[model samples]
Target: MALITKTDLYFTDYSWSAIEPDDPRVTGEPDSTLLNRKEGYEILYFINKLSDIWSLKNKSSATKIERMIRFEVPSNIHSQLTIRIWIHDNWNESRY
Candidate 1:
């Protein structure tokens, strides 16, 4: 497969896929992000995974980063969780 770009991920606040092994909702917009249910916990799992990915891929150029994720498992998801990313392109792909 070809290398993936950061934007491809930003499109998702969270992801739920067997390929990456992360739950959904983690990447959903906070205000729009749903929690307090199975979907919420699923999102949490996804947030953790994204954090891991962003750290490894965007560490140097990442001017800002936040999972905006809060709350413990089996608890109510935070109403005001937030995540941010510096959004620097990691790959050497040339853009005209």
Candidate 2:
């Protein structure tokens, strides 16, 4: 596999201009107002399995990162729920 950079994980704000330019909500919209206008996102549970994948014998070859996320949303909501995971990458840092 290839290296994972910061830009690969970056998510931009939602824009209504592309979908509906004539909509009143899209006119002179603030940065916050343009983001996630319809969907609701919540993180119910997040787990990082670092120790399970880390091995002393294969430390040099163990470069992959594994993540598991679980979300439980109620059926009453009309719109779909969204979830995002933010990761900070520090090349100089030794700690994983």
Candidate 3:
């Protein structure tokens, strides 16, 4: 079985994040090969939406969506992660 050392999560609202590089499940680099696929290591994740509301409805002008992500891992170790959120059309790269 191939190991899954990296994980990419995406949301319907166009938000995304990745967990990689120093992920606790990754014991070491995989052997150099055509696919560079790792073995033996695996990571499992349980995704749940903390908030009850998935979409905004009759929200006040003062209210806003926070662009942030927080999660806990079994290893209790810190790893570098990146998250991308779609703020608007102008901010999109394809426009360039």
Candidate 4:
């Protein structure tokens, strides 16, 4: 059997005040808010490449897979936030 390694991305330090309305640092616009802070904030992370090397050795067998990702946010922030995830096979280097 081959070893499967896993990694995770953790997000923290999110506070209501940091993203509240009328936060000048968020944007120069008078009505700036966390909802429209900037374009760069839209992306969370990117994986350069993902390959199923094990598939080559087990071509005739089907691999059973379950939920491989878990997203957890503090209960306190759950009601006040919106989260989105996007998966793309290719990404721009500059975006990283």
Candidate 5:
């Protein structure tokens, strides 16, 4: 007899919140600053997970990232979504 294993992939729906200028999270902050730092942090965390699942490196190419996104997200969501890649000077060293 031999042991066997199975794996499956699942996609979850995501929603973005509307940010107001008067919101305490961004109130009095410069326009150049992050509008939604929490959201940005979550996105970065998700991207890292994708990279791990796809055996990708931290500096993986944009095309590779796109492919991973396409593979993990449903077609309908991907089609209607817009993705932005932010590359900070210290991205590799930053915790978030």
Candidate 6:
């Protein structure tokens, strides 16, 4: 259900963007294993705001959440696919 839209990082210099090397849902390379099997269920949709009209267009949730996957099996595709977003900290990773 995530239509491949991404842009949210207040950045202290974090950068990585590599897509289209025969992209089949990026089957394992960037941080180990990612292939949303023929395409589905890689949902990373986030929205946030503390309210009091601090409007990020009015979202009152999502401190942090993440997911990623994009794929195409057929159809005359031009803009292929990719949406790798995985940074949800899981208690700061002790194999959470």
Listed in order, each prediction's TM-score against the native is: 0.23, 0.16, 0.14, 0.16, 0.27, 0.22
lDDT of 6 by residue, 1-96 (tens): 222233442222323354554554332233323433232222222212111112333111222222111222222322212212222223243231
Superior by TM-score: candidate 2 or candidate 5:
5
- Residue 59 of model 6, lDDT score: 17
Model 3, stretches more than 4 Å misplaced? Answer: 1-11, 21-44, 48-96
Q: Candidate 5 lDDT, tens digit per residue, 51-71?
A: 443455444332334334444
Give the C-alpha miss distance for residue 65 in model 6, angstroms. Answer: 1.7
In what order do the candidates fall by TM-score, top score first? 5, 1, 6, 2, 4, 3
Off by over 4 Å in 2: 1-9, 12-18, 29-96
Q: After superposition, how far is residue 86 of candidate 5 from its true place, in Å?
A: 20
Candidate with more favorable, higher lDDT: 5 or 6: 5
Candidate 4: residue 90 Cα off by (Å): 14
Error of 5 at 57 (Å): 1.8
**Per-residue accuracy of model 3 over 1-96 as CA lDDT, tens digit each:** 211112322222332235464654333422121111112122212111111113223222001212122221212322212111221221223222
Error of 1 at 20 (Å): 18
lDDT of 4 by residue, 1-96 (tens): 322212222223223233334334332321212232122121111111111322323311111111111223222221112211111121121122
lDDT of each: 0.34, 0.22, 0.22, 0.21, 0.33, 0.26
Evaluate residue 27 in candidate 1 and report its C-alpha lDDT on the 0 to 100 scale: 42
Candidate 2 overall lDDT versus native: 0.22
Backbone clashes for every candidate come to 7, 0, 0, 0, 0, 0
Candidate 2: Cα lDDT at 52: 25
TM-score winner = 5
* Predicted structure 6: lDDT: 0.26
Per residue, candidate 2 scores C-alpha lDDT tens digits across 32-74 of 2222322111110011112122222332222222111111222
